[model samples]
Target: MNKSKVLLLKNCSTGLVSQVMTLIFQFLTRSLFIRYIGIELLGVYSTFTSVLSTLSLAELGFQTAIVFSLYKPLAQRDEQQINDIVNVFRFVYDCIGAFFILASLALLPFLKYILTGITVTNAIYLYFLIQAFSSACTYFLAYKRSLLYADQKDYISKIIDMIVNVIANILQIIAMVYFKDYLLYLVLKLMQVIVSNIWVHWVCARLYPFLKRGKINFTLLRSLFSNVKNIFAGKIAAYVYSSTDSLVISAFISTVQVGYLVNYTTISQQLKTLIAGLLNPITPMIGNVLATDSEGESKEGAFKLYAVMRVLIAMMIVVPFCVLINDFIAMWVGAEYILPASVVVLLVMDLYIHFVHSVNVDFINAAGLFREDRDNEIIAAVLNITLSILGAKTIGLAGVLLGTVVSQMWFWFGRSYVVFKLCLQADKEDYLKYWLKNIVDGVALTVSIVFCAYLNSRLPIANSYLKFVCSGILCEAVSVALFGVFHFGDPEVRKMLKYLVNHIGKR
Candidate 1:
């Protein structure tokens, strides 16, 4: 096997293992948290996580641009150029870290306003401080890990992160159970972040001993910052679009409601993280392919296969999610903690939309079209926030998630258009067919969800866990069957199935 395929397998296998372990620990921690601590505190944890995530947007997508810049030099084995780029990366992160400190401090007074309905205690501020410090530490200390990412050595970091997460989750569980102190739990979380980053930094340094302080390449730095400026707009838009939902809920509704929502989101996020982890290996390879493939034939073929895979994966996930999410929540916690059916369906739909387009979004970044999609991202951001706030006040939680689904509709077609026109340079008919196919896939997904929901309603299982398991199995089977019925004749699907079967047979 070639180097790229080997790297992809290594990354995917390690990432899958990491995500599975992390998911288990996350549920265990969250379960202990709700049982020992309070759901309100869980809400606070979820709220502050979003707030800190939003604050971290000060990094302004520079890491992405810098990583993109590294592809060519690394591909050519130009160590000097790589070192210079790393120097630029180091300098930029230092500045970002300093700025993060100042920004976090400035936002301290406003925390009272953001954490509405919850008492703004000094311990809360201290917890935020520790979390902020941990985040800033990444910028100042762990920026070298990006080089590993650009080098397609992400499996190294994945393994380190998995180890750290398991250990941290174990420690946090002990703290929550024995100490029963939220502050101690937060401290353990901080330690986890620091330790993981430090490990990645060490691995990067050992692997790339040639990395050292060097003269900054001003011209390359300038070009990178130019990409950063365009990418920054999209970064802010993305941050506002996704991270602010919690903030809006906390401000308009209650932190306790945010806590209720967090349970569902935890499941969604864990799955999304797993999906991203499995798919992330493909990104650097895509970048490498784009850097070298001038004719776009290889890019188009890979994308078509990935597009089908994306739909298949989304169908498998979203359908089961719609059918079984509430049952799982009830089984995991209690039915009282569950959100309404409307909210659950909307949440699953939102996840479906995001999962379906995740590949295209990654492709857009690989194509370096941040500047092109700047306006579209900004518009979506504005639409999401506006609609979410309004929907929250008017129709409540379901409406808030509904805003997310509506806003992302623009992204679904908009991203595909840009990828086809600029990236692939495909003809109009191909783009139209892709759009039509996506529409059919969306319909199939929605119909499958309904069918699965009806099937789940008819299941005779009395036990909660058993019901969840049975519903999940039936939902998945039905979703896959529906997908095959819709796309069995698709040339891309046939080619992909043949490819997978041949590869598995070889194995």
Candidate 2:
């Protein structure tokens, strides 16, 4: 295997492990929150967290742009350049942190509007403030971790992140169960953020001590700031569409309803995060390959990567679609707050679009076309917010999702296609042909498996648990079989599989 492949595999393995642990932790945390705190408090918690996330605009797009800038320098093993970049980025991060502190403080007057759901209780306000402060601290920590990621040390980062999250979540569950206090829960979360970020900084510093030695480069500072301007604007726009939706919903809908919406959104977002963890480490590698290799080699590698990613995305989409998430939610969180069927369906659709968007967006960002990417994000944000609000007012949550899908067609899909074309210098027809083939194969396989699972639901199962277990197993089995037979049977996929088999056999 080539060095890139080896690094990809290492990162993927560590990422998968981290994702699994994180998912488990999330499940436990969600379960505890639902059972102990109930939906009302969960709503308050969710809204507060969402507000805190928006405050994370402090880090801006510097983290992403900085990572991209580091790829070539890191690849060339230019120690001085790496040190300069790191130092300059850290200095910027501190400025951003200060900005966040000031922003958060300034937003206090407007907290009543933002925290619309939460009562004006002193304790609740304090909890929200603490969450906001924690979020600010986390931004600085994340800047340090971005250096590690850019250096292709994501495996190390992932391990530390996963371990910290798992430990923190366990403590959170204990806090919820024992104390059942929302303030205590928020405090625990704050502690988690502080500890996790500190760990990230510590780990990165240990791995690359040279980062700590560099003098600030004003020239690098100017360039970093310039790139960050576009990135920051893009992130603000992205957050508008992503995090702002929840805040908007909280504004119009009941807090309990916000809680329900957040729960479904959380599941969908977690799934995305899991997929991203698997694919994201390779993004910088893609940039590095494009920067270092011939155009043909880069295109070929990208095509292969896209193909593999589509298969992984198929698994991500179909598995959740197949499992009766409504049943799972009912079982997990109780039927009292079970998400409506329409809400669930809309959530799934949103996730599908989101998955596609992620694949294309990562490629676009990796290609260093931040300006165009930023423009697309601006369009997406405008359309998303406008449509979601209109939809929510007219039709409700499903309408919000419908608006999102409608917005994506022109804004996201069109922009992504253009980015793909521009970055890879590949023909539009060729790209469409590949994706069309995957869509057809994936749809057919998904339908066949879902049909099989639907039939199994007709059978008499003694218990709900057993039925769920059987349905899940049946869905996965049929999907894998159908995908393998129809999709993996393709010559290219087969060759890759055979190579993997032989490679593993030798190992």
Candidate 3:
């Protein structure tokens, strides 16, 4: 396991530790929020988290710009360049921190307007301020955290975040169980975040001793800011995509519905995180490879590994969600919280499409292709916003999600063309055909698995828990057996499998 495999394995391992802890915490805490905290406050809590994201938009891709800059220096082992880059980033992040505080306060007057059905105004503001301040702490002095990832040591941060999240979530649950005070629970979260930021700064110092002695100059800052400007559009696109729906849902529908949406959102988000946890480590490897081989002569092999990974991960999540979301939701919470069938189907479809789109995006970002279709991201964001608001007004929640689906047409087509042309220097037809073939294989295998599972008489059960468990296991087993046989029969797939096994065995 060298760079690519090593990075992937470590990231997945550490991410699993954090995700397992988070899943446990979320299971207990979400149930508690519904039972003890009421749906309205749950909306407030989730809403403010969204609001904090908007406020933090002032960050404006500074950290990402810094991380991208870091790849060159880290690969070259140039300590001074690394220190200079880190220094400028710290100053910019500090300014971004102060901007967030001011921006959040400025929005306070309109907060009640954005949120529907808010009775306790002061509590909302206080909670918003606390969340904002706690988040800002990381920006002020934590810029050095990028080095951990650039050096492929993200496991350090992942482990730290896991410990903090586990402890914090546990304490918050206890506070709710004992006091049942929303404000108290929020306060504990803020304190835990503050502590985590400080701990991250300490870890950064311990890992990179050279960071403490560096002189910053505008020349360096200006050079780094160019990367920042290039990637800023991507940053906006991501934040807006993730957070704007909350605003729309809060403004148009009742705040309570936003809480209900989280029932579906929680699972979607966790699956996305798990996938990212596995794939994100490969990004730096891609960057390193491109830095050395700009012609992308290395891409065809990488694409095969990525294509297989995309199919496996996407099906592992989407097939189950499509087949068993209703049953899972009914068993976990209740039938009452489940959305309508239309919305459920759309959500699962969105997850599948979103994951497929994300596969190329990691490569695009690694190749510094953000500036290629920066304007198109603006178009997509605007389209999503307009369509979401109108769709929610016309059809309902499913319509709102459909807006996001429609907007991704650019990603599936436009971005792929650009990456295939500019970065990989490969034929667009070949790339498109590869993806088309993957979609066909995945869909056919999924249907076959579902039909076989149904034939097994393991589905359509009366009991919710039994239906979810039986269908989930059968779906996974059948899908694996079929997909494995389908791909393992390919010489290319067999060659890659042998290479991966040899690499890991050597490690």
Candidate 4:
């Protein structure tokens, strides 16, 4: 195998392992929290985390901007340029840390208003303070990890994060079992964040010793600032897009409803995280390709193959999710906790849209086309918030989720246009053809999934767990068969299969 392939495999293996471990620990922790601390506290905890996530915009998208800036330098082995970029981020992060602290404090006074479905008086403030400070302190050293990512050493950071999270989750479980104190739980989480950031920083410092040397390059800094400004706008939109669901549910609906949604979201988010971790190893590679071969035919070919893989994965995941989620949720929590069928369907549909479009988003980021797509994201965010609020007021949870589906469809179109026109330099006809093909694929997958769901419902399994297992198996089988029939002649699919066969034969 080639060096790039070896690195890609290594990164994917480590990332998948770490993400699986982390996901297991997170589910365990969440389940324990619900069992011991009660659902109200879970709701409160979810709300506070959402609020703090909003505060994360203080980082101002610097990590992404810096990482993009490093791709070229790293590819060229320009240590001096790498150091200059890292130092600029280090300085900016320190300022961001201070700013987060101040902003968090200013927001503290209004926390009471956001505190719905919880009766904790003064302790909540302390919890927020610790969480806020932990978040702030992360900026001081977390910038180093971006170096690892841009250099295709993501496995190192992933491993460190996994270890830290495993230890923290174990400790938090013990605290909940023995003391039943949410305060101790939050502190444990805080320590995990600090340790993970510091560990990554130390690793980067050791791996690239020159990271400590060299001053900021004013020319590069000016360019980075431009990217940051554009990326920050997208960052705001992203935060609004993902983070506001819980907050909106808390305010417009209730925190308790947010808690229930969290149960469903937990499964979906973990799946997304796992998929992202497996796929993210390829991002820096994509960035490297864009840096080295901006106009090369190889880049476009790679993108087409990637797009096919994403569509296939999305189909596979959404099918099982649609068929088995309600049963899984029933088994994981209780039947009462399972969301309304309409809400569940909308959630899965939204997830499918995200999975399908992720290829374009990743390419857009790799190509550093944030400036071109900034307004697109802002518009999507606005639409999401507006639709979500109006929907929540009118139709409740389903409406809120429907807003996400609509916004993601908008994002899908906009991002595809940006990637084809700007990044790939493809013409309008080519872009429209590619866009229409993906839409057809999405629609076809939806039809297949609906059939799979109907088949699952017709199964005669009586036991709930057995039914879930049977439903999952049926969904997987149906999805594979349908996609095989649907894309039997797809060149990308054939090429991927041939590569896989060759790889296994070599093994």
- Highest lDDT among the candidates is held by which one? 1
Ranking by lDDT: 1, 4, 3, 2
**lDDT of each model, Cα atoms only?**
0.86, 0.72, 0.77, 0.84
Please give, for residues 147-229, the per-residue lDDT of candidate 2 as tens digits. Answer: 77777677777887787787878778888999887677778788878887888888777777666655789987777777778
Model 4 lDDT at residue 388? 94
Using lDDT as the measure, name the better of candidate 2 and candidate 3: 3
Q: Give the clashing residue pairs of candidate 4, or none.
A: none
Worst 10 residues of 3 by lDDT: 452-461
Cα lDDT tens digits for candidate 4, 1-507 = 998788778788988898788778777777778878878878888888889899898777779888878899999999888888888888888888988889888987887778765665788788888888888878876888888888888879988988888888889999998889999998998899989998888888788987665566678778877767887888888898889888888878888888889988988988898899778867877888888885667778778889888888988898898878877767776678777889988988888888988999999878877788988899999999999999989998888888888989999899988888778887888787787777778777877888987888798988877888878888888888888777789889999899889999999
Which residue pairs of candidate 2 clash? none
By the TM-score metric, which is better: model 1 or model 3? 1
lDDT (Cα, tens digit) per residue for candidate 3, span 304-422: 67767677677767777777777677777777888887787677767877887675787787886778879878878888889999988998787788888778766667777776777
The candidate 1 region of ten consecutive residues with least summed lDDT is 277-286
lDDT of 1 by residue, 14-90 (tens): 87998899788878888889999889888887888788888688788888888888899999999999999999889
Candidate 4 residue spans exceeding 4 A from truth: 1-7, 71-84, 208-223, 281-304, 423-432
For residue 433, give model 4's deviation from the true position in Å: 3.9
Error of 2 at 93 (Å): 2.3
Query: Candidate 3: TM-score?
Result: 0.88
lDDT of 1: 0.86
Candidate 4 accuracy as lDDT = 0.84
